[model samples]
Target chain A: MRFNDKLRLAWKKNNSLVCVGLDPDLSRLPAGMAQQRESIFEFNKTIIDATHDVVCAYKPQIAYFSAYSAEEQLEQTIQYIKTHYPDIPVILDSKRGDIGSTAQKYAVEAFERYQADAVTINPYMGFDSAEPFLNYQDRGVILLCRTSNRGAGDIQDLIVDGVPLYERVADLVANQWNKHNNCLLVVGATWPEQMAKIRNIVGDMPFLVPGAGAQGGDVEQLVKAGKTADGTGLIVNSSRGVLYASNGPDFVEAARNEVIKLRDLINQFR
Target chain B: MRFNDKLRLAWKKNNSLVCVGLDPDLSRLPAGMAQQRESIFEFNKTIIDATHDVVCAYKPQIAYFSAYSAEEQLEQTIQYIKTHYPDIPVILDSKRGDIGSTAQKYAVEAFERYQADAVTINPYMGFDSAEPFLNYQDRGVILLCRTSNRGAGDIQDLIVDGVPLYERVADLVANQWNKHNNCLLVVGATWPEQMAKIRNIVGDMPFLVPGAGAQGGDVEQLVKAGKTADGTGLIVNSSRGVLYASNGPDFVEAARNEVIKLRDLINQFR
Candidate 1:
């Protein structure tokens, strides 16, 4: 299935807009969860099992896996998700950008090798850096725009022509690069006004909204500003808030509870 | 030993300005080589052995290794380089960027897991995205500036205020971020004028200039425009032109010959 089709199906079936991030920091893992690949995989497996129904997608940050040389564990975790929760697509959050040749290898790494349904890319180098990912006609390529951090305005908010850089990015992606119809934009939920502006520019292309949880974004405002007419155009991601909910033995349950609450809150807004 | 110190030592010792990219594409590998991690490592070993004397640094693009699930081979290759060619710093060409927490993981991946001396990063998300990589006071954090590709100007050349965006990036990196003296910038050999302009802006900062060979960038102009007063500010990289010099069994020798020609050409211009 195409990435958007699968995402639409998952959204309808689960009635959710939550994208749980599988970012496992060694220092932040539960007590007794030693810094090993096996523990990380096990923790991910438990979290996946607990929150599958509440999630529209699973976004695994590549840095967490690459940090420990736990790529095998990451692969296995994706496979486990595919085998068990087949409808929930896996988005590998690797903001990779390079020239054409290097971008091709990254495409292989994200799509063929890791079997992720979608991937994130940085748009600094413009079309060439994102072309390889967009060539995957069945996959989704999410580009960073209006990111959710303090210093994001340093460059992203730079005025070009008459509009900010992020709006220019949205215009470029919406008008120029969405030929394949598989492109998405990442607008942080913390900037609801910008997200609303971007939503107007991009029409209905899904926005992978981060910063809805520990990053201190208001979920209701984000949903109100970012949702499409059908109320299915946002993937509100909560990584630390969901994954590290409780360091105790009931961490999985706590994560499940947190995702359930976030999903319901998003649905109520929808 | 700091990264720049090691790079300077190698540049002076070898009297060369070539950075050979280890972008081993599986389809481009020599015939009869089995598709296994061991074979990949062996191919890299042969290539490194042949080009170590002629090149100043060995840049292994992370995408190529990650594509074939050969990250172990990448690890082993870096270890081999450290043991065998200690002075030649290994720059992991992973243009990684993310938010603060995710960026932290990427820093761990580049420094702790791979143990690379330097790394390439994308600055699209602004300062916070580059902050985690910059926090590594000992290692080098090379930011992407004017890229070598054709469409690099789509966003990079967009004029803001009165200057182009890339010059603005140079200003930011030079004035704000190089406090630890571990910052570098990427300027494409394809745009020698821009390279020279950037060179003038950031007086002595090292420029990782790609697009020398296969990308049709002129070597003499690049060397002349990119070199510092001491003739040691440009690390011109040629990947496919060196690696795919010949598809025959004499590939290593052919690669060495190509790199030698590039190194001598750069030195002649110097």
Candidate 2:
């Protein structure tokens, strides 16, 4: 299935827009969690099994697995996700943006090797850097617009031609990319006000909106900022706010509940 | 030996400012001269053998090698350089710039995996993204400032708080990075005026100046633009113009002559 259609189906079947960020920080894993080589795969599988019906996608931050000597484990983690959580979209949050050749290698890693449904990419290198991802018709390439961080404003909010860099990026990710393949723009819920403007600019490209929970972004305000005639194109991601809700044995169940609550609130707005 | 000291010694031995670019285009190699799989390494090895002592450094553009599926061959090619030409600085021309964790992975790839003496990095990510690279004091992180490309002025020349983006990067690479590790800057030879201005901002941080030969950059103007007090901070590079000097069986000899010619002209100015 096309990534967008699969995402739509996943969103409806799960009754949620919550994406579990599998950022397995070795030091930050729960107190009693063992440090085995396959600990990440084990942790991720449990979370997927418990919360499969309460989440739209799984977002894996590449850093956590890349830090160790067992770097091959990252490939195994993705293989497990593709096998067990096959229906749910996996967004490999790599944030890569380089020249044409290196960009091509990353495209292979995400699509051919890891088989991620979508991947987060940095847009600093301009159109040439992103062209490789746009070649995959069945996948989604989420370009960073206004990221959920303090320093995002340092560059994302810069004014150029009376438009913010994020808005300009939204236009490019919409117009230029659609000519080739699927594209999504990342808009943080913290900057809800920018969401409405971005929605209007990009028309209806799917938005992977992050920062809806512990980051303290107002959910109601964020929903108001992103409402379209079709109310679809929004994936409000909550990682730490849900996955790390409780560090005990009930962590996955606690995560499911948090997702359920957020989904209910979002359903009301829809 | 430390990277800086090795670079200085190599420069003294070479009496050459030239940094031969190993941008091995697979199709351009001599017929049956090893197929595309290991052609890049095969070609690079021949060039290095003929002219290793004539150049201070060897710059391998990340895109060229990445364009092929021979990741293993690329790794082997680099290992070959590090093994045979240990003193010849191999600056991996990968303009990678991303967030903290991913940046750390790239540092691991460039420093540990490929074992480059210096890796060109992108500075659009700001200091935090670059901090991971700076933490590796044993290596050199060359930040891209004012590039030699036509579209470079699109972003790098942007003024903020009374200083250009390139100037801001230079200031940050000099001040913030020196706090942790050794840092260098990339100032393209095509932009002599920007090179002179960036030299002032970055002081004596070695500038990997590309764009002299096939790229139509003026070497004499570049030599004038980047000459340091000790005549040490410029490693002006020529890629296709030097490496592709001839396509026949005598290609290596022709390639060596090209390097010798460029090196003589640069030394004359010095």
Candidate 3:
């Protein structure tokens, strides 16, 4: 099935648009879990089991695994998610960008190796870098538009012709690059005004909205500006805020509660 | 030592600016080697042994190894370079970009896990994405300015304040982000004219120039346009052209011959 169809199914089944970002930082893992070899995967499994019914997607940030030389764990984590919670799309949050040939290898890494349902890509290198991923017609190719970072405007807000560069990116991705109807934009929740503009440009296209929790993006503003007419377009992510909600033995329950609260909060505005 | 100091030492010792890109595709590996589990590392070893004396740096494109679940082989490849040819710097061609928090993990992946001397990053998300990598003061942080791909102009050539986006990148990277003097720009050999303008903007700052071999970049134009007044500002790379120069038993010798010819050709322009 195409990523969009799977996402719609997830949205309807869960009654939520929240994506729990499984960015398991070793230093911050729950009390006794940090010392184990399979901590990252174990932590991810616990999180998935706790919150799978409440979220539309799960985004695993590749760096968190690869940094600690735990790529096998990442593979296992995604495989476990696919095996158990297959309805929830796994978005490998690796913002990879390169030339065509190298990008092909990255596509293989994200899709074939990790078995991620969808993968995020950096669009700075343009169409060819994205082509290899787009060729996987069933998967999602989410492009970074207006990033959540404070310094995002350094490059993204530069005026091109008359519009901000991020707007230009939205126009191009929505019109020229969505041939497969699998392209999604990463419009940050921190910039609600820009998010609304991007929504205007890319009608009904889904967005992987990051920055709701630790990055201080307002859930009300994000939902008000980004939701589709049917109220099912945003995959709002909460990483540190959810995963490390409580570092004690109650971490799992805390995470589950946090995700439920976030999901309900998003639904309130929707 | 700092990345610049190490690079200068290697450039002086090797008498060549060629940075052979170790992008070992499994399907493209030589006869009798692809079936072996250690083929990627062995092939890299042969290439490094053959060309270490003539080249200033080695770039290992991370995707090729990670695509095949051979990241251990990538770690071994870089460790081998550092252990054997200690003078040559290894640039991890990752092109990773993310918000600050995730970027920290990527820095750990490149510097601590892979032990790369330098790493390439996509600067689309702006300064925060590059900061974690820059914090490692002794290592190199190479940012993509004008990529070598055909679709580079899609976002790079857009007018930003009367100048191209790439030029703006050059200005920002050179003036603001090079605080530790560890930042470099990736200007493709395919666009020699744009490269010349970048050189003018970031004077004497080194460039990691790809697109030299299979990408059909002209050596003469690339060198004439990218080289500094002292003729030492470029690390020209060749991947497929060098790695798959021959798929037979004589592949090693063919690769060495190709590197020598490329180095000499670059010298002619210098």
Candidate 4:
């Protein structure tokens, strides 16, 4: 199934908009397991088993795995998710971009190797970096529109032809690049007003809204301002707040409770 | 030694600006050897052995290695270059960027795992993505400014503060991000005017100029417009024109000849 349709199904089936970011910092992993690669896979498996029913998707930040030289473990983690939670879509939050052939290889790495349902891309190289990801008709390509970082406005807020650079990026992605209906924008929940402007520009396209809980973004405002007319177009991600809710043995249960709280809060806003 | 000083030492020792890109496409590999990961490493060994003396740096585009799931071979290739040709620097062309924590992991991936002297990064996320790489006081952080691709102008050409987005990027990289003196800019040789403008913005700072030969970039114009006042500070890259110069057994010699030609052409302009 195309990622958009698959996302819709997952969204409705779970009746949730929470996307748990699986960014396993080794220091934060619970005690007893050696910091080996398999330990990460084990931790991810536990997290997925605990929270799959409450999430619309699982977004794995590739850097966490690559940091430990654990791409193999990451592969296994994704496989575990796919096998156990077949209904949940996996979005590899790589944000990789390059020229033509290199982008093609990255596309292969994300889609074919990791079997992600979608991937994020950086658009700094213009269409050359994004076209290869977009060519994957079944996978979604989430472009980093207005990032959640503190200094995201250094370039993204630069004015261009009476529009900010991020808005221009949204316009380009909407009018030019979303031909396959597989394009998504990443608008941080930290900037709910900007998210609303971006939503207006991109219309009903889904926004992978990071920075909801741990990053102190007002989830109520995000759901009220950034949600689509159907109330199911925002994937509100909370990484540390959910994953590291309690690093004790109750970590999985804490994660479950956190996701339930975030989901209910989003639904109340909707 | 810091990356900028190391780059200068290598540039002067070799008296050349050619950065041979090791983008080994399996389909384009020479016959007579099985297309395996080891063969890819062997091919890189030959190319590095053949052209190490006439070049300032070796840039192994990570996508080429990741395409074959041969990051191990890539690690070995960098180790091989460091062992045999310690004077020459290796720029791993990753173009990676993410938030603060993720950026920290990617920095480890490039500098610790791959041991690249330098790595490319996308600057769209503002400082959050590039700052971690910059914090490596001795390693180089080359940011994408004006790319060589045909569609590079999509967002980069958008006017911000009456200057193009790329120039603004150049200004920001020079003024705000180069406090550690480890920052470099990537201005494509394909756009000599933009290259000259960026050079003027970032005076005396090094520029990794790709798109030289097969990308239809003018080598002489790049050397004349991009070089520092001392006739150095440009790392001109040519991938296909050098790596795929010959698909026969004489591939090594052909690659050496191509590098020599590019280096001499650059020197002549200087």
Candidate 5:
């Protein structure tokens, strides 16, 4: 199935749009699991088990796993999710961009090696960097438009022909780059006004909205600005806020509670 | 020593500006080694051994390793160079960029996990994305400015303030972003005019120039446009042309010869 259809099914079945970012920081891991060889996968398994039914998607930040030489754990985490909760899609939030040949290898890393349902890419390299991933046809290629960070405006807001660069990116992705229907924009929840403008530009194209909880993005404003006409076009993400809600034994349950709260809050606005 | 001083020392010691890219494609490996478990490392070892003296740097594209779950091989490759030929810097051509917290993890993945002396980054996310890497005061952070690929102009050529975006990137990296003196710009050899323009903007800042050999970039044009006033601020890279110069057992010698030829040709222009 196409990533869009799979995502929509997940949204309907779970009645949510929350995406839990599995960024397992070793220093912040629970006391007992930090020293274990397979701690990342083990912790992720617990979180996925607890929140699988409550959330629409899982986004594993590749940096956290790669930082500790835990690519094996990342593979295990994704495999565990596919085996146990096949309905929920996984987005590998890699934000990778390169020239054509190098970008092809990255595509293999995200799709074949990791077996992610969708992957986020940086649009800085332009179309060839994105073309290899879009060739997957079914996988989602989420391009960073206006990121959730404070310094996102450094390049994203550069005015070109009287419109911000991010708006041009939105128009280009929606009109020219979405020929395969596999492209999506990353319009951060922290910038609701920009999100609304992007929504206007791209119509009902899905958005992978980061910066909800830990990044101080208000759920009400995000939903109001980013929702499609049918009210289901956003995958709202919360990483540290949801993953490390508690550092103790109840971390798994705390994570689940946070996901539920975020899902319900987003739905309330929708 | 800082990356700039180390790079200049390599240039003076080796009398070369060549940076041989270590992008090992599985299908393109020499006939016998393709099926071996340690082929990536073994191949890189031979290439590095043969060309290390003729080159100023070694750039291992991480995607080539990570795609085949060969991160350990990448680690071995960089470690081999550091142990045996410490003067020749290793640039991890990752092209990574993300928000601040996530970017920190990527910095660890490059500088800590791989122990690369320098790493390439995509500048689309702006200053904060480049900050964590710069915090490693001794390491080199190369940002993408004008890429070699034909589609580089898709977003890079977008006019902002009556100048192309790549020029703006060059100005920013040369002035504001180089406070740590750890930043370099990636200017492709495929476009000499743009490279000359970037040279005007950035003055004598170093450039990691790709697309020389297999990518059909001319050595003379690249050197004329990109060299600093002192003629030593460029690391010209050739990947497939040097690495896979021959499919036979003479591949190692062929690689060395190609590197010598490229080095001499670049010096001729200088």
Candidate 6:
């Protein structure tokens, strides 16, 4: 099935858009720094087990995994998540973009190795770099139109040919990539107004929103700004807000509570 | 020492500005498919062995390794080169850029994990993303200026506020990142005119020029246009033109012949 159809089906079947980010920053791991590689798998297993019912997808930021000893370890971490939690779609937040040939490799890594349902990409390299990723039908290629970070506006909001850089990127991803519509835009929740503007430009494509908890972005305002024409297509991500709910021993339970709370809030708005 | 100081020393020591690219394309591996992973390592070993003394540096485009299972293998390849051929500076051709936190992780991965002597970065996300890579003294961060590609003019040639995007990026990476002065610009050999313009703007910073050889970039024009004030600072790369010099068993020998030819051409121009 196409990514959009799968996303819609999964969203309806799973009843949530909460994507638990598996960014297990080594410094912030709940326990076992000595077992750096295994901790990610262990922590992710509990998080996935606890929150699987309430979320439509899981986003494992590749940076955190790739920071370890070897690519095999990174693969192991992602593989563990996919092996056990087969139903939940994995969005590998790799943010990879390069020339055509390299892009093909990244595509293989994301789709073949980790078998991610989608991978976050930076579109700054132009459409050529992104074409390889967008070519995948069963998977998705999420472009950072406007990121959730504070400095995202510095460049992404710059006026280029009158339209902001992010707006221009949004137009390109939606229009040029519309031949496949395998592209999704990332509009951070921190910028509600820009999100609404991007929502207009991007039309019906799904948006992966990251900034609800740790970044202190307003969820109510975000829901207001991010509703698509079909009243769907928003993956609200919370990293530290949920995962690190309790640094103590009851971390998993604390995480469950946090995810349930966020899910309820999103559901109420939806 | 600065990147150019190292490049100049190596160039003088090796009597060549040639940087052999270790682009281990799976389909074109010297050995058959069964040993694809091992063949990539073996191919790189031979290239490094044959041209280590002749070439100033080795550029392993991260994408080629990423094309395979792509996690541990890419890291392993980088480690192998650095450990086995420690004298040869490995310039990881990864044009990475993102917000602050993500940038930090990428820096750690490139500088710490891969132990890359230098890395190619994208300036589209602005200096903040590029700064982390520039923060280290031992490593150099090469920013993409006027790229050497068919679509080089897409966003790169865009005149923003008065300056072309590549020129603007060159100025930013040159001036802003000099807070540490560990910055280099990736100016293409194809855009020798623009490369000179960017060099004039970026002053003494080193330039890693790509798009020579099989890309049909004019070596003479590139040398004439991009000569530094001291008549150096160019690391012209030739991937397919060198690595895939032959489809037959003399592939390694053919690659060496190609590099020797390009090296003599560059030396003659110099």
Model 6 stretches astray by more than 4 angstroms: A32-34, A73-84, B31-34, B70-85
Model 5 chain A weakest lDDT span, ten residues long? A30-39
Q: Candidate 5, after superposition: displacement of residue A53 in Å?
A: 0.8
Q: Could you tell me which 10 consecutive residues in candidate 5 chain B have the lowest summed lDDT?
A: B29-38
Q: What is the lDDT of residue B96 in candidate 5?
A: 93
- Best-to-worst order by DockQ is 3, 5, 1, 4, 6, 2
Candidate 2 lDDT, A1-270, residue by residue in tens: 788888989887887777877766555565588876567777776677777778889888765654443345667777777777788888888776654545786787678767889988876656766778888889998988877655566566666566776787788678775675488888888898899899989887888887787677888888878866766678888777776778887887887888889888987886
lDDT of 4 at A207: 94
Query: What are the per-residue Cα lDDT tens digits for candidate 5 across B11-118?
Result: 999999999999998888887786554799999998998887899999999999988899999999999999999999999999999989999999999999899999
Each prediction's Cα lDDT score? 0.91, 0.77, 0.93, 0.91, 0.93, 0.79
Q: Give the clashing pairs for model 6.
A: A71-B71, A71-B72, A72-B72
Q: For every candidate, how close is chain A to the native chain A in TM-score?
A: 0.98, 0.95, 0.99, 0.98, 0.98, 0.94
Q: What is the lDDT of residue B108 in candidate 1?
A: 89
Best candidate according to lDDT? 3
Worst window of 10 by summed lDDT in candidate 2 chain A = A63-72
Worst ten in a row by lDDT for model 3 chain A: A32-41
Q: Give the best candidate by DockQ.
A: 3
CA RMSD per model (angstroms): 1.2, 4.1, 0.9, 0.9, 0.9, 2.2
Per-residue error (Å), model 4, residue A70: 0.4
Interface RMSD of each: 0.8, 3.9, 0.7, 0.9, 0.7, 2.0
Off by over 4 Å in 1: none
Per model, the share of native interface contacts recovered reads 0.88, 0.11, 0.88, 0.80, 0.81, 0.39
Give the clashing residue pairs of candidate 2, or none. none
What lDDT does candidate 3 reach at residue A229?
97
lDDT of 1 at A110: 96
